[model samples]
Target: MYFFLSHLSVCDILISTNVTPKTLQVLLTGRHLLSFSSCHTQLYFFGAFTGTECCLLSVMSYDRYLAICDPLHYSFIMKRHLPQFLATLCWLVGFFVSMIIESFVVALDYCGPNVIDHFFCDLTRLLELSCSDTKMTDICVTIIVSIIGIFQVVFVIVTYICIFTSILQISSITGRQKIFSTCSSHLAVVSTYYGTLIALYVAPSSGHFQTLNKVLSLLNTIITPLLNPIIYSLRNKEIRSAFSKNVLRRLKR
Candidate 1:
């Protein structure tokens, strides 16, 4: 229980921490906080954290794949130490990659009309606001999105395919049903998460798509955190049992 809470807290911090500085800056500047250096910093962290999340979700999906498809070798394959190592590597890579992209964005100066259209700091929105020659920034963003976002989506799809294929190979109908039940919750989450993510980042960023992008971003950002615990408690037998046990114990006390 303590371990789960600790991890949940970390996720909360990672997702919400970035909002504070930007909010402060906006309040101070009366909603026009797009200075050259500030814009660069915002874009850098935004890209980094966004990329980190994509990598983290892919890693989590892979963990589920190992747990379900190859339970016998799961521990050996993804021991505690390996997860920590992988997570650190993901953060480092995400930071450096985002930094490079932000550098490209900062190289182009804004001439006028620096009003960013989006609520939060995003690369494409920032580029759209730029009155300077933004072709370089656009190209860099396209490459990064293709490599990080699209690549992770493809990897997740492949992982699910493998997981479903393994489940189908089970001979007994009951056994197949059991396996599907274990994975269905994760599949739901992965589909919603990756689906919204692809729509937000991979789709063409235009005025027509802005509303859809904001909605999907809200789904991924605010909705997923609330849904995760509910999904786990409702779909996972062990978690449900644990909750019931805790509740009953408290009642008896």
Candidate 2:
């Protein structure tokens, strides 16, 4: 699971980096030679990893929900073997889904006005630049995104709602507090991630929202990754204690 997650992270960095913006500018604006195969490769990898990340996040949220809401069966059900199987399945599904969407995207040939307005090679931005009638692409991308992205967000929200409701129902105040602390970090990460994503993509795309969309997109893509580790490490006592112990041992050596 860790390895798959790391792979997704690396892919995200490759696709979302500022280098892509520069490359796109050179290709679209500066009359640089761009091979059709190269563009296809870029779209393939970018979609693959991004789709994988979405599925991985949903899986992670389910894992957290099981751990918090069904603690008694978590160890037995979510063992190392099960996690490995689930992670593999998620990656496979994400890869195929992305391939199908990207295949459709590339099938639409570019005739003129290839200037992409956005920073990265996002499907929507690419569609906007295509000279071909993109009504089909627009509908297709919107449907897929709604199914994959919006579905995952909704699933996480629903699962967490149940988990939090269970936490609140605890009889003892101290038990409730402990449960809240245990789940709070995950909740924070989820809110920050989905909140920004929904604002950027699911909201109405208009000139009025363009600047806001860009700002939220950058926040979700860049800042959220950096903030996730910090939020988890700081709020999680076990992780903090382990880190402190490891540091102390290293210093003593």
Candidate 3:
């Protein structure tokens, strides 16, 4: 799980780095300006990292399913190299998917009025700026989201259903409680991450909530990364102990 967590951390870092610096620049300078290449570059990395993180969350759920449902063989199933292979595959798939979408975006003709309404470059906002036909671009995004996003969300749900069934079989109350506790954090993170995303992209609404959508996008890009470490790691005993020893102790001095 730590192996997967490390990769998830990397995704969050990439996402925050991709979006926040430019957002900060816009705020501090009061200039909401981005060059064409820079906007596209940001768009690509944002898509890539978000997609990778989606896959990673599903993979982590699968990891937990194996660990809880088949503890005895969990080590054998995960193996020494399987985690690395899975992580690498997630990265490659994300980049490939993002590249496809980026290509479609690049093909669109942005004749004039290239103002992006959002703080950073977003696929939807970018699509709105294009003068050419966006039907193809819209179709590509729908396909990708249906395949990668919805599929992964369903996969996690099914995996957890199996996990819950296995948990219920444990005779000891303490055993069931302990196992549920392990899953609760993952469920929280998944809910928050995917919930914000679904609200922003998948929900059907009008242009009236563009401002609200921007807030949701901020929650997705900025607040989610900020919450991840606290949700996943800080509550960990070893991490808390280390923080106390290293950080708190230094502050005391």
By TM-score, the candidates rank as 3, 2, 1
TM-score: which is higher, 2 or 3?
3
Q: What is the lDDT of residue 189 in candidate 1?
A: 64
Off by over 4 Å in 3: 204-206, 238-253
Lowest summed-lDDT stretch of 10 residues in model 1? 1-10
lDDT of 1 by residue, 1-253 (tens): 2232334435545655665556555657767555667666656776676667667667767777887788999879877788877677767777888888877777776777767765567677777767688876778777776887778888988998998899878899999888777767666766776777766766666868887786676666667656766765677678889989999999999
Error of 3 at 237 (Å): 2.7
Error of 1 at 253 (Å): 26
Give the Å error, residue 13, model 2.
Answer: 4.9
Which candidate number would show the highest lDDT if scored against the true structure?
Answer: 3
Error of 3 at 165 (Å): 1.1
Each candidate: RMSD: 4.9, 5.3, 3.1
